[model samples]
Target: MVNSKFEFTNIKCYCPVDKFCHVEYCYLKSVNRSYKYFSARSNIHQNPITNFTVNLALLKRYNGYKPFLYNFTVDGCKFLGNSKAANPVSKYFFEFFAPYMNANHKCPYDHDLIIEKLPASSMDYRLSKLLPFPEGDYLFNITWLIIGIPHGNIQIYGSLS
Candidate 1:
């Protein structure tokens, strides 16, 4: 649930009707839902290689962050879940994907991925590389992971390494 305190914009709904959006999000990729192609609801093709940063806490709430309509992809990215107790559900999701991510990755969350605020940021990509993540593969967007297989040439800027 989005807080009344912060006002967001351009919110689109891509969730299935059955599962509690989050859990459904997990099943959609593996279960092979209708979105075999890049669907708008999934926001798959909006890969801006965003120099803009992601709002991890907002992502935990609305599944994506939008202070305004702008680049919302996680190409060159950071993983806040590994260090702080922010999004527990999202943290669990990442943990499930850990083996494939990186061997040296450090998970931050102590509890079960609770939806809380961490000292998060937006557009802070310069120092992210030196922060230590997996070699070869960078912290690509969580949307990339959620969308599973890609059907077209998705230009992810951060994962260039």
Candidate 2:
């Protein structure tokens, strides 16, 4: 759920409903879902390669940092899931993939593979790469670990530095 305290621009998912489903649930169902393409809901004059910064936080309501995997497919990019924790160095792992993601499309594999420890750390070293413009727009899929608690925070940002 998005909080009212922050400002966010609402955008719709351009992909068909079947393709828009997050991959974590498929794992929960013990199924392998198909990966298809999607376009950004918002219009961009130029496809900006954003520096994606994903921040995973432990929900205050939970005992500790929760763990799981999330997955989704876009522009035929396939990101796999890895279990990890929330430590100082691990922030870069999330940043490595940040260049590929946006606010609407998150890693679908976040629910299945979760980190077991608090103050966890892991590194995903996806290099800075340009995403091909989709036939209509750009799309990419990501599979990453996330916490299990409902209240954990997620943040996305573009780096000017």
Candidate 3:
């Protein structure tokens, strides 16, 4: 078995439509060699999100960030209701952090979406065993769209070795 180590290097959040939604906080905290956490909070100030979509792009740092294995968009509501059928790749990635997020339910997200203190270890099996990836730096570029309009973006940067 290949012994792998995964760690989050940074997290960045941006809300283009600040009047309608905004990211309160997004950060990666490392307490020790074995303890690391990633957190992000986004507030929806407008009407409840009845419909939304997410564009996921996985990029690897070769000479620079280049498209890796996956790049697709999935309907957020559909994914929340039936993940496997919506998109297996997105489901796999979503499951990596779903346990720590409060936005797992179906459409109409009326409350603040929060992902707090998501331990990095939660992704060990998926990143190392289930879908083994080459040792390198990676970036997950995720864009949130409400009714086909861009609302926010979250970029998660990490490395596997």
Candidate 4:
């Protein structure tokens, strides 16, 4: 994919003065913790995906942690090709989310994003690998984390994991 045009130019998160903050730095302590355990587990010859799962969970928890800018964009795209500039909410989700969680890097409709409104307390879950271009060809299992967030935040998290 082409690089995302979306940019978050002036975020004021508390960073140590001497170093540049990389993406991993955004999740610093968790990233370090992930590294420590991952290194030990890898030494014991466990699959890398397990380590990844732990790290991803930590990253997910970052959602509950305070964000430097509650109002921000993360994905690299600014707008869907046919999206209206007048729609502020859509604009916010696409730009902030497309890269942060890496979903519908283009426009959701353009990418075939399948959306359904499930009941608040339902135990049923939906999983989709297609109707969304590149993601459409892949398979994913929906899980409790996907159901835990409010519907609005669910979309913010890209397709449910």
For candidate 1, what's the RMSD? 17.1
Model 4 lDDT tens row, 62-161: 3452222123222223334444652564343233223323234343212212222212111111122211121211111111111132111111122122
Please identify which of the two predictions, 3 or 4, would achieve the higher lDDT against the true structure. Answer: 3
lDDT of 1 by residue, 95-116 (tens): 4333332322333212211211
What is the per-residue lDDT of model 3 for residues 1-161, given as tens digits with 9 covering 90 to 100?
66987888888998999798888899988899899999999888987788899999999999999999999998899889887686677888898878999999888888998989888787666888788888999998999888788898989888999
Model 3 lDDT at residue 94: 93
> Residue 71 of model 3: what lDDT?
93
Stretches > 4 Å off in candidate 2: 1-27, 31-46, 60-88, 91-161
The top-ranked prediction according to TM-score is: 3
Residue 83 in candidate 4, Cα distance off native in Å:
3.0
Estimate candidate 2's RMSD in Å. Answer: 18.8
TM-score of 1: 0.21
**What is candidate 4's local distance difference test score?**
0.21
lDDT of 2 by residue, 52-146 (tens): 23333211112432222323212211222332333423433445334334432333322222221111011101222221111111112222222
Worst 10 residues of 2 by lDDT: 116-125
The order of the candidates by TM-score, greatest first, is 3, 1, 4, 2
lDDT of 1: 0.25
TM-score for each predicted model, relative to the true structure: 0.21, 0.18, 0.94, 0.20
Deviation in Å, model 3, residue 152 alpha carbon: 1.1
Indicate which candidate wins on lDDT: 3
